[model samples]
Target: MEVSKKNKLNKIVKEIETCQACNLCKNRIKSVVSRGNENAKIILIGEAPGKLENEIGKPFVGKSGQQLNDLLSKVGFNPEQDIYFCNVVKCRPVRNNKDRKPNKQEIEACVKYLNAQIEIVKPEIIILCGNTAKKIFKINKPLKMVHGSCIDYKGIKLIPVYHPRASIIDEVKFNDLKKVKKLRG
Candidate 1:
């Protein structure tokens, strides 16, 4: 990455850390930022941070994270070197009952940061790993309908896939990831 780009990303991360754009920030323990190579060719975007991710201020560090990691290995991608992991909402959206999906307002508030990351990374492929991510990308179809298929959005290839935590875990999702690898190449 260029020095200027690195500096710009740092500036964005700082802004995210201190942002008070929505109510999600009010209860967050830490603002979960991105992890992995800044020059990564593939970016994996999830919906929001879960409990463990919130505690660590890192995206994809929970059970779902483990699943993702395994999937990456199976597809011959390196998390630390080839892919940048992030979430649509940087903070955990907790409610009275349990950690819940980020509401529309919260998603709206945090999307700018995600957009900034996309611009900075300029990834060749962006994996929208769940419904919320697909929604943000304006992909109206169900994940099952489009998962593994790459859609050209602007110039980037957007691949919708099932969230790692989704109830159904199967080889089809793994196949989808393999498709991602092929597309990345």
Candidate 2:
């Protein structure tokens, strides 16, 4: 099962590597596919790649990723072994040569890849790490208001949380992360 899952994920990685469906394809140094364990039952979704991620071609590998790693550790989860890290938009969203939120068109174009990742991984829990990630699930509300509640996404637990860059872990986010430790296994 793990081998098939890994094979399917590898195909998706190749597909993402050559994606030219959006304008981001023009400026991106590399298309950030995903990172961490493919067999993980948990998926951590961020908004898009940052500068480091764009350069390295992996999601959640910047300073923010380190912070997220610490948080995951505090919550009793191992990022390398338990979480499948990805982003809503694969390429780094940029404006004025600085990282920026992905626009609607970009999100729409790359959403198929995100959807495919989810389908292949079939994770039991999805942690939406910021508003952009959360909004893709059609929950149009502020992260402050919705963070930490587990909404059902096709039988999977969908959790909205502040971005690691924001460093804002509310009570709900903390408890939710802590509570899911048992499920990580």
Best by the lDDT measure: 1
Output the number of the TM-score-best candidate: 1
Clashes of 2: 0
Instruction: Report the C-alpha displacement of residue 113, candidate 2, in angstroms.
Output: 0.3
Instruction: Give the per-residue Cα lDDT of candidate 1 at 125.
Output: 93
Model 1: how large is the Cα RMSD against the reference? 1.5
Candidate 1 lDDT tens digits, 104-129: 99999999999999998999999999
For model 2, which pairs clash?
none
Encode model 2's per-residue lDDT on 1-185: one tens digit a residue. Answer: 35597888889888877889999987688889899998899999999998999999999899988878887898888789999999999998888989999999999999999999999989999998889999999999887788777799889999888887775544555665776675554
lDDT of each: 0.89, 0.86
